[model samples]
Target: MRREAVLKQSGCRHYRSQPTHGIGRYKHLLPPEPDPKKKDKLPRKEIKPSSDHEYGVLNLQVSGYNMILVEHYSQYVHNLCSRLSIKVQECYAKPTKTKEVMLMQEHSTKMFLDAMLTTHERVVQVTGLSSTMAPILMEVLMMNQPEGVQLLVKEHTEADYQVRFKGRPELENLVASMS
Candidate 1:
């Protein structure tokens, strides 16, 4: 009975007034007007890592001496990229005349090279060649070595700390020994 009396005395139902749009308030509720300039804006160019640049044949005449030029390039990369790790992923696969074979080999070599470079947590692909195009290849790779480089030397195996960068020659030797 007390609850019923309190409810009767209280007049709270339907007391709130409907909201009206104030000055400039209606614009907030409407869809945004399209900008003609923004609709025609040019697409932004993608900034990929320097190592991710397309592999190109580079011919550099670094004072006509290839090895010296390569050493200089290597030193430059090492000095410049103090923060990033630098490594050389030397690829020594035999050359194939066939386009398909060459492309596939190049692709595979690059993938392996990338993996080896990544092991050091570096950021460049240093593809080297000791062929007629050696100088050119060195130049190209050096150009791409902004952050650092993985020197992928082709057709040369010198045993110091390593034979090849990924040590394919060493692996071959082990396999042959096992056989």
Candidate 2:
């Protein structure tokens, strides 16, 4: 009550308004208030604590000369992981070929990779060596990579997290569908 009087007289237009705009005369009707008494009293949200037990896979990113080659290598890795009873996330199941035109796919993929690293996610990218192209691509990629990346490495177990991709429309939509 006293605060309102101070605000009204102090010429503070923010907390109190002058007779202007559509509410010129009816300013009293629209009280300048985030009124405590009139507050909706929304129920406090109770956040359920996540269980200590968690399951996740070791993400093995397989890239090669091409998507086909990468998929082949990925399959081999998958089989090996299965044999070793290792939890593998299989995020690389369907390889999006470079030939298939995807909208800003390179940028999106880069963003995804950056997010993965930022979150301290355990990711070991394995590039298949079909030919010299792998080396060239590696060199190009290495150019941007920071020196002493070993320091960035963080360890995790299968119990740490789960991996899934909420498909991006840019990458998901077909070239024909886009138009």
Candidate 3:
């Protein structure tokens, strides 16, 4: 028996007819629609808002064992130094992120501080501190840090309140006094 005749006898019209590519009437099969809500949602893996901590700088003037706390995470430290166009003599990394890096400059504290204050307006804007407060903070640090004191920073925020003096027994005694 012929295949077409057999198919026709079985009541199967599709197999009985010749197959056509695109010229015949075809049954359309549409894909399922996507969920609208899922498409509108934001991704969950973005950086968290609370994670503000970042790499920070520590400005110091260390002469021998004596270290001076110049400035903390404030822009005064970074911007002022950059404006003064002073090159860093050395950089020492801190043991922890919360700790400070030791920075040594070639010039004296008075000269360095002058450059820092000269750019006071810019420094205040960059560090998010008032112009008046910047000078006062510098004054405090200069008066507090003694010979053989090691300057340390507390992290991303510049020198301000987060600055400290380490090294030297006398400085240690002074640090104890500050507390």
Give residue 27's lDDT in candidate 3 (0 to 100): 43
Compared with the true structure, what per-residue lDDT tens digits does model 3 show for residues 1-179? 69769877867455325566345634435566778777564233222122233212223432222112222323234544445443332233231212233445676453322221111111121223333444554575457555443434322333432232233888888999999
Report how far residue 20 has shifted in candidate 1, in Å: 99
lDDT leaderboard ranking: 2, 3, 1
Residue range 107-134, candidate 2, lDDT tens digits: 4553222221111112342222223333
The worst-scoring run of ten residues by lDDT in candidate 2 lies at 112-121
Query: What's model 3's overall lDDT?
Result: 0.37
* Cα lDDT, all candidates: 0.37, 0.39, 0.37
Top candidate when judged by TM-score against the true structure? 2
The most accurate candidate by lDDT is 2
Which of candidates 1 and 2 reaches a greater lDDT?
2
TM-score of each model, in listed order:
0.18, 0.25, 0.19
Ranking by TM-score: 2, 3, 1
